[model samples]
Target chain A: MMLEILTYPDPRLKEPSTTVETFDEELRNFLSNLEETMRAGPGGVGIAAPQVGRFQRIAIVDVSSHKKVTKHHGRLVLINPEITDWDGFEIAREGCMSVPDYTGNVIRATHIKLTAQNENAEIKYFEMEGYEARAVQHELDHLDGLLFLDRLVSRRHDLFQRKTHQKKK
Target chain B: MKNWFMLALVGQDRVGIVAQITDALYRGGCNLGEASMLRLGTSFTMMMMVNTQLDENTLISVIQPTAEKLGLHLHLDQIEGELHPHPEPDVKIVVHGADRAGIVAQVTGELANAGLNILDLETGVGGSDKKPFYFMQIEGNATQGMEALQLALEKLKETLQGNIDINLSPLETFDL
Candidate 1:
């Protein structure tokens, strides 16, 4: 049962999801279908449970399926995932399946560790870097109702760039 | 449907500009949409997309006084359609080196040659006099990946002799 990927303006994408409390067949079926839906899309590496209209903390990311993911190594099905640590920063442009026709530079931690549950309700741990790290962050945003646009790094010049707009004396 | 208006304001940087403008618009019942405000050197610019039940003439009349009081130039144009995210084919182009002539033209010329369209280009020359620097950020699209245009910039930096550095990344869009 492959689920429909929710696009922007879909209220479901904005509503926050709850944690997955049980590791049962229904959850397994949803996870599997979510994985299928993600794999079937072009340039898709991950999908959150809420994306398919399931308001639960479940997401599947198989970076291995993306042409560029082969350069990295990791595939995950996460339930109630939490980031325990983060380090550094990388700003890169990102597009989302949920929000089409836009891509913006998002700041992501260069390194991160995540604690989550697999389909069996078993706890899984991940320490990853590079594209995989960004994929995880992007999927995690959905669980909390955040799109990359929410993390846009525009106007960074407010911090250090010379103020060319200063009034002349 | 409500009418859309684009308001552009540029003037010397100062406090209270946003407060005054927004307060007036809020009082007039204007719905503000996507907007960007930036300070460049001694100048400040703000561009906003707004929706309201007012006509362009009414908008200018309402905003013009604020512009006059602040000594800012204003341009307001009525537009149609709702504002949404835009994904143009572009790259994040960063060029930095010592200040000099023709840096912009040389780089933009290269981009033009590669068939790219620039959406936003910001150039600045600032730093200590002993080590003045030129910095630029060009948001543009060249029908190819960063690698494809590598030679265009590498050659320019080689010829310009500013010890120029260039970084390019594809402006990727995820269309579902």
Candidate 2:
């Protein structure tokens, strides 16, 4: 079943999710719903479980089919992921399904080396950059129950109209 | 507490728009606090923060008809509640260069190495092949004990080979 996308200011979006202790059928199903929800939302590249009314420590990211941007390819199911190291800073415009009708310019660690448990229950460390890295950081923030608004630049110059500034896509 | 309402109005530009809206506010017992208006082409846009603690319903009701009669699209909401200001300092950086490969990676790579938190950023490429302008605006805060902020910005300026300017300033807010 496709997950329902949550909009901004919904208290459920702010509740810290419980960690997934085991990779089982339920976890796999949650991951699939995440994929579906991400694809369903307008301009969505990643989504977390909390965004779909489930406060579970899980997120899924995929930027492969997003126009000319070449990012880390494939579906990334991050179950209790954590950043181990970062290599650079990249600033980009970010939008969220929960925060409808607004997008902000956010600075994020551009290159990240992190570890996460995938669907197969294998713990893996991966290094990602470009669009993929931005997507990962955004989704991970959702797992912590923090909306992008919480980390926004807190300045007018920090936000923008997404339609006028959309990158070549 | 002063319960102020922020109202935005958009409609064709002509005389009497302001007087009409303010007249309704006067009748409704709302006092204007802060206001700004501008003309966009044939349309005029106005925004005001009106104090209405005693009777919000009356203020909204009075202005609602004025807006309708004037063919204006009006929106009214309570002023944003008190928000704790972020204490960290901020800087704005602009990166511009040829639209080439790995420009963002090269610049952001330096930012990551320095442990700065990017608060906001936007990037785009324009112009033509002979003279392309890859522009980006980055707002970030530096980590403690890092090199001088200017020094770090200058270092990025040199590394990316893009014309860079860094401005350290307080937080900002404005309407479109």
- How many residue pairs clash in all the candidates, one count each? 11, 4
- lDDT value, residue A2 of candidate 1: 69
| Candidate 1 residue runs with Cα over 4 Å from true position | A2-18, A40-42, A71-75, A144-146, A158-169, B1-5, B26-30, B51-55, B78-82, B144-148, B171-176
- Candidate 1 residues B1-176, lDDT tens each? 45888899999988999999988788788989888888888999999988889888888888888888998999988887476746365577888988878778888888678666787888888799898999998887677656658777777767876578878776655322
lDDT of 1 by residue, A23-136 (tens): 888777777788888887766688888888888888777676555544454668888999999998877778888876667777889889999988888897888887788888
Tens-digit per-residue lDDT, B79-123, candidate 2: 763323332325556667667787777777766677667866667
* Native interface contact recovery, model 2: 0.00
TM for every model, in the order presented, reads 0.82, 0.51
Q: In candidate 1 chain A, where is summed lDDT lowest over 10 consecutive residues? A: A65-74
Q: Model 2's lDDT to the true fold?
A: 0.73
Worst 10 residues of 2 chain A by lDDT: A154-163
DockQ, every prediction: 0.38, 0.02
Docking class of 1: acceptable
Candidate achieving the largest TM-score: 1
